[model samples]
Target: MRTLSRECGVTDADNPWLSRPVAPQPSAPAYTGAPTARPTGPSAPQRGVPAPDRAALLPTIDQRQDADLWWLGAHGGAGETSLAALIPGWPAAGHGWPRTPGAAPARVVVTARSSMSGLRAAQTSATQWAAGLVPHVQVLGLVLIADAPGRLPRPLREFAQVVAGGFARTWTLPWIEAWRLGEPPALTAAPREVRRLVDELSALLRPGADGTAN
Candidate 1:
């Protein structure tokens, strides 16, 4: 199977540059203004040394995190992609998740319920999770309560399964349960409960502190 990175044009399927890894050599010391005399010795014969590839020297990031939640927002418009712009104090650089601010440990909070939301969620999570610098994060999705919000859409079905069980008609509160049990919560119910859910999830993500249930 073609890797998603290749499909998305993020990487080349047959990239010759990535064939071998190259270690970076230490930077040469700066030269002082004084000039040195050239040595009067025979030149050594050049041997077979492979040319270094620039791309091969770059770092590869693989996803490694126990807690990452993706929430799908309503279809169309900015969708969940807007999440990149919304986090407080996050810098507007890089294609993946924003870097954590140095002032204080922080958490990312995105809310949406659309298939696109999943893609956007990944975009936001990649930076922190890939670097393994951020703490476990809870992805909370406030699925809009449609009168006939059919079976969880394919994009959200997986997450709903994790948090909402398979029954489409039921109202599962995985986030709430997690909050109550000191686990990071990932999904919550209707409008009335969103603020509280986010607050609880935020607290749970806070360093040196565990969330409390009512």
Candidate 2:
């Protein structure tokens, strides 16, 4: 059978200008976009990567810590940092399951770049989560950060749809030049999409949330 990449005709030649991975970086500008694909349930057999030792990944946060959410990067440079910074109350875990002994499972949102490697890393994380390989965390959704300043390639978009099946929901962000230049994003100053995202995340993050998609 033809693979999604092959089906969509995505090849290495399509992504010739790849760069190093990093964490979250939100933008202060406006962008109405292809924000997400509703969950289609987890795809276990195809394109899933085996999970890692999650216990070793946790660094242990104090129970007294005030934060209520964690941004887990699916890979390095997935924009977990910027999203964490976007909401002052959240923190980013550099591609790990954030667990503290004696505490309830921490809430998390996985992030990745729109590039093939980034989204594949996200797929791996989501598949592992669905397979119960990741522990001590409730995944909120997947967030795909733009790797560049243009529309996503057709193949990547289609492949992203396949990856989105593993999570409760997913959100995508456009490439912000200001963020690339080291500018910070503010909820009050951000565009409508950012505001909407903040609102949705805030509601799901409230106490008693079961991490269900809105």
Candidate 3:
């Protein structure tokens, strides 16, 4: 099984605000279980985003459920909606679209602190997305993910840092960075040095480690 290095786990150390978990390729069983369907039809494409074609990246729903957590980083980079569909169950009560009085609420702050307008926009987008899916909440872990790195305004990056601090797990999507440029970030097949960092970060995600358990 491939593993992430310690360094890969956290975000940019120099800028704590960008701290996030390095992506891990967990065992297939980790995300196996539950079966969720995807909404059909053409999804409007965002400019400057070079995501993987939706039809080419359908995830196995059952696998997503088996895992304790998943970080859907496909935002505008690949089949994000298709990947999210892999989680069979819907988001819990408060977290779902049209959030309930008190549900599995997650604050989508766009940094450590954001103005009222940004928060409102985040909530609005979240609600709209949630509305299209089913309603159930087994989300003990936060799906700490960002949307559209290409368009990531300054406020959102700060908000991402705040969310990163609060959650035990985080998934940084590679494509968003590509959006900032005009293409995807290059990946090295022999990324020995980089892989070591990933291992370290994965270690921190475990229970009883940094005391950041779910």
Candidate 4:
């Protein structure tokens, strides 16, 4: 009997269903794993390499005591010391916050000139105080010392307005020729504007009085 395979000339070797051996896949490369002995803390410098002084990276801030209020400079030359002397408050160097040992008042008056730059600094400080960024310090108000003896230029006046707008209370001091000449202006001889500032500050600092003054 003629078989179907013989009729079609099919062979066992030509059949696709025949089993075949597959080449083995290459072995995956082994991982040694990450180093387990990483040094802790700051990395050690190379031999003979001088280590940087970490302390010098930050500027030093001086803190002092005395007085019920602190006059902080919003920027350099903000007349903090002079205003402190005139206003019966502690003088804070630069913008450093006051640090008294015990029972010291946290009320702070940020001082700056009426110049554009000074006004900007005052605005930043007022915003920070309003946001409570300055720890343990209550911002009473802003004191803007006149940058010149005469009326502020229109631009500076506008800038001053922008800065004072952020604060609930603000005091502006007119330019004193004596102060510019390195002499303290006597309170009695002070201008009406200056006297008004003194009166308001005195009222605000009175015992059992809230920090705000009209």
By TM-score, the best candidate is 2
Instruction: List model 2 lDDT by residue over 1-214, tens digit each.
Output: 1243342233434311111123543322223342333333432222323343453232333333424667888778888887776765577775677775545676778888999998778766765565455556677787888899899999889878777655667778888777788888666666666566766676665445334422
- Candidate 3 per-residue lDDT, tens place, 1-214, comes to 0111122232233222222122454332222222221112112212222223334332323221223333332122322232223332221122212222334322121111133343333323322222223232121222332343354677665554454332333334322343345443222321332233234333433444332222
| TM-score, per-candidate, Cα-based | 0.30, 0.69, 0.28, 0.63
Candidate 4 is scored at a TM of 0.63
Q: What's model 4's lDDT at 106? A: 60
Residue-level lDDT tens digits of model 1 in 77-186: 32233322222222112222223323322233333233444333333332223223333322222233221234555646544333221111112222233333444322
Q: Report the candidate with higher TM-score, 2 versus 4.
A: 2
lDDT value, residue 109 of candidate 2: 80
Global lDDT of each candidate: 0.28, 0.62, 0.29, 0.56
For residue 41, model 1's alpha carbon misses the true position, in angstroms, by 65
**Candidate 4 structure quality by residue, lDDT tens digits, 1-214:** 1221132243533321111022442221122232222111111111221212333121224355444667778888887877655543444545665655545436667789999889877756654443334445556777899888899999888767666654556778888777788887555667887666656666566555443411
Name the runs in model 3 displaced over 4 angstroms.
1-65, 73-201, 205-207
lDDT for 183 (candidate 4): 84
The parts of candidate 2 lying over 4 Å away from their true place are 1-66, 208-214
Maximum-lDDT candidate: 2
* Candidate 4 residue runs with Cα over 4 Å from true position: 1-66, 87-93, 103-105, 210-214
Root-mean-square deviation of Cα positions for candidate 1 versus the true structure, in angstroms:
21.8
Tell me how far the alpha carbon of residue 142 in candidate 4 is from the true structure, in angstroms, after superposition: 0.7
Clashing pairs in 4: none
